[model samples]
Every structure is written in structure tokens, then in C-alpha cells.
Target: MKKVIISLFALVAGTGFAVAEDAGCEAFKWPVTREQALFAAAPATPSGGTLAVGAAADLALVPVDKAAFAVPPEHAPGEGTFGAVASVAVPPEGAIQISLSGEAWIDVIQDGKAVKSAGYSGVKTCPGIRKSVRFKLAAGPATIQFSGAKKAELKVAVLTPE
Candidate 1:
């Protein structure tokens, strides 16, 4: 009994796996705040499918917290940008594809810098509605950073070679 109790305690403490504390739309029983709404917009992976983000409404230059949208920085030199850190182990020559959505702009970043940026303007079923980009991985794992969106929601996915 003592050993079992200690093992259970150790398991929870050792690994950082905890129940999904962030209540999804339930916590805010009544009036919902912008922050709450924004977080809720995050996309969830289905049973079997590629991962990506989604937006609920048309996002403008300024994003209302809790609103489902992608983050797009402005056109300024150091303006529109998003931050993401990735270091995946690659065997040899490999490539990956990144998909994004929302009313904001997004840039594909690697190694703490922006490699490619795509401007996303919303039109009815037109090109800017939702966008995607692809990048060929280098020899090893690489870090990526994205930025430059005025007020848009964004999502990213990494597709490895099969």
C-alpha cells in the first residue's frame, strides 16, 4: 500500500502530464471575455487528419481577445510576426508543409527568423481566405518563428515524409 501510494504520487510529479485544466467554453458559464473566446478558437486535432487552425468570424486589423482568428502582423519591417519554437529530428533529406488560416498575415520562420511570408486578405472563396506554405527541412532539427499579422487567427502544421 505504501509503495503504491508513493508510485502514484511520483508518476504525477515526475511527468508534466496533467488534466486539461483550461476549460473549453464551460468555465465561462455566462458572459464570455475576449481572452476566453480567443483561446477557445484554437483548433483541435480530430481522430485522424492533418492538423491546422481555424477562424470563426471575419477578423479585422485589431483582434478581439477570445475571437477565433489568426495572428498577422502589419507590413512594417519588425511589425507582423508570430513566435514558434520547433526542433524535430530529421533523418536525412526531408521536407515539411505548413498550413495557415485567418484574416491576419503569417510568415514561415526557421532558426529564429522569417524565411517566407504570405499576406492573407479575405475574399469570398478567393485565394486569401485560407493559405498554406511549404518548406524543405535542412539536415537536422530547426526552430521556426512566424510574425507579422495585424489582426488575424493563425494555424501551423508540419508534414513529414512517409
Candidate 2:
């Protein structure tokens, strides 16, 4: 009985010491200087739309008829799904940024399949600033889409590997 108890104690102690640990990744070192830090910041990509010169135009102009604007009844509000468009191409190493005028649920699709999805609730008034999401795509091109009941306008931008 004494030997069995001692063996159990030793096994428990050994198992505790073998737990997983988080190692600081040296490859992801922080910025050394303020200038370098600023440079290291992620760069924003241009929207795939026309450039505006003055105060921004109203975003909610009906691009299509009301029936056309209606989302498919089956599509739920959440991440990883879009009511319009089929696929998005994401670079293998960078991320994608989307600008919206209202709240939305965004979905990410890759290689003709749904990879993941996320919901982004409203922050402020309509035509809010852009929200960026980073996704590592060692696999291939990715497609992202946004769908929600809110009448938000949206534009998409893609960032590629340097």
C-alpha cells in the first residue's frame, strides 16, 4: 500500500510538470523604435470603388429594387455568410477589410467552402468606419461576404502578402 501511494504521487507530480506552455515567439518580436512601430502597423488597402472628392455621398441609395435588396429567407444574421455574391478571393498571407454604413454579419469562404463566420454589431451611426479582419490563408483564395437586416452600405478591400 505504501509503495502504491508513492508511485501515484510521483505520477501526478510528473504529469503536472508536463503541461503545455506558451513560448514567446521571437519571430513576432515587437517594434524596437517608435518609427519602426509606426512602420510595422498594418497598411490599409484602397476600396475597390470609385474615389470621392468631396463630402461623401449618401450611402443608402437604392442600388436595386426593394425585392432585389431583400435577403434570402434562409440566410441568418451572423458571421461567415453573405446574402449577395458567391465567393471572395483572399491572399495566402494577408487579410481583408470591409467598410460598412451599418451593422452586419460577415462570413468567410475559402476554396469553394465556408471556413468561418463572425458577427459585428453596430457601433455608431450609419456609414461607420471600416472594420478589418485578418485571416491567414496558406491554403488559397478566400471569399468574404456581409449580410444583415440593417440598410448598411459596404465596400471590400483585400491585402496581400508582402
Candidate 3:
């Protein structure tokens, strides 16, 4: 009984598994404390097939086939991987950051073209996030796509940096 309990404790503490909340975010090139906190919180489930999300809305996600993309993803998913896309309204701030709970390809498509990333950072040791991508966006709507995900369902967050 003690051995079993110790094993469980070891897994919870750290192992060759996913990260724990507040673990490795500070290592990121830019500060990701806000994103880390939101990711630690229970994610909001999207209603319908559409994805109109706001700050701290760490989403459970919507999986879709590659054929659904009006514009192809910048990086394609490897064999056996999955993908997800969300139409997000970029706030007037003109720049926003999208945080991911898993490793995947991220693309922000607006007006049928990909918006270039303004900043990029991620750490494998971060418990709830695998990476975060920032884009310089116009104040309006954009399509955020995630490809090459090993899992069909993933958690995501889109936030306007302060």
C-alpha cells in the first residue's frame, strides 16, 4: 500500500508526463503568467461548431478535418495527427497571443492569408501549456487553426496582451 501511494505521489509531483500548473512558464521568452493561470482554470466549452472566444476562455476545442480549411495550414499535420480551427474576433489592441495546451502547428488566417507571428514562445516543461504564439492582427476577425495535434481534443486560449 505504501509503495502504491508513493508511485502515485511521484507521478503527481513530476515525471515523463505532462506538466503541472505553474511549473515552467517563467522560462518562456516573454512573460506567460496570465496565460498559465487561465490554462490552469477549467476551460470553457465552445457552443455549436463556431469558436468565438475571449480572454481566459481556455477552450476544450473543436476538431475538424483538413478539408474544412478555406486556406491550408502553414504546417500540415503528420500522419495520424488531428486539427482544430476557431474564428476569433481580434480586439482593437492590434496584437493578441494564443496559448496552447499541447504541441501543434498554429496559424492565424485573415482575409485568406496568414497573419505573421509577432512573438513566439513555449516550454515543454510548462504544465498546462506547450506553446504560445503571438500575432500582429488588425482589429477584427481571424481564423486560428491548430494542426499536427496528436489528440483530437485540445485546450486553447486567445488573449490580447496588455
Name the best candidate (by TM-score).
3
Q: Best lDDT goes to which candidate? A: 3
Clash number for candidate 1: 24
TM-scores for the candidates: 0.36, 0.38, 0.74
Better of 1 and 3 by TM-score: 3
Candidate 1 has a TM-score of: 0.36
Candidates ranked, most accurate by TM-score first: 3, 2, 1
Candidate 3 Cα misplacement greater than 4 A, ranges:
1-23, 44-54, 57-67
In the range 1-162, model 3's lDDT, one tens digit per residue, is: 999999999987775344433457766777777766766664465422344445555444344464366578887667777776678887787788888788888888988899889988878877777888889988887887777788756667777765
Q: Sort the predicted structures by lDDT, highest score first.
A: 3, 1, 2
For candidate 3, the per-residue lDDT at 4 reads 96
* Pairs with backbone N, CA or C atoms under 3 Å apart (clashes), candidate 3: 19-127
For each candidate in the order shown, give its overall lDDT on alpha carbons: 0.36, 0.36, 0.71
Weakest lDDT window of 10 consecutive positions for candidate 3: 46-55
| RMSD in Å for all candidates | 18.6, 12.2, 8.4
lDDT of 2 at 31: 15
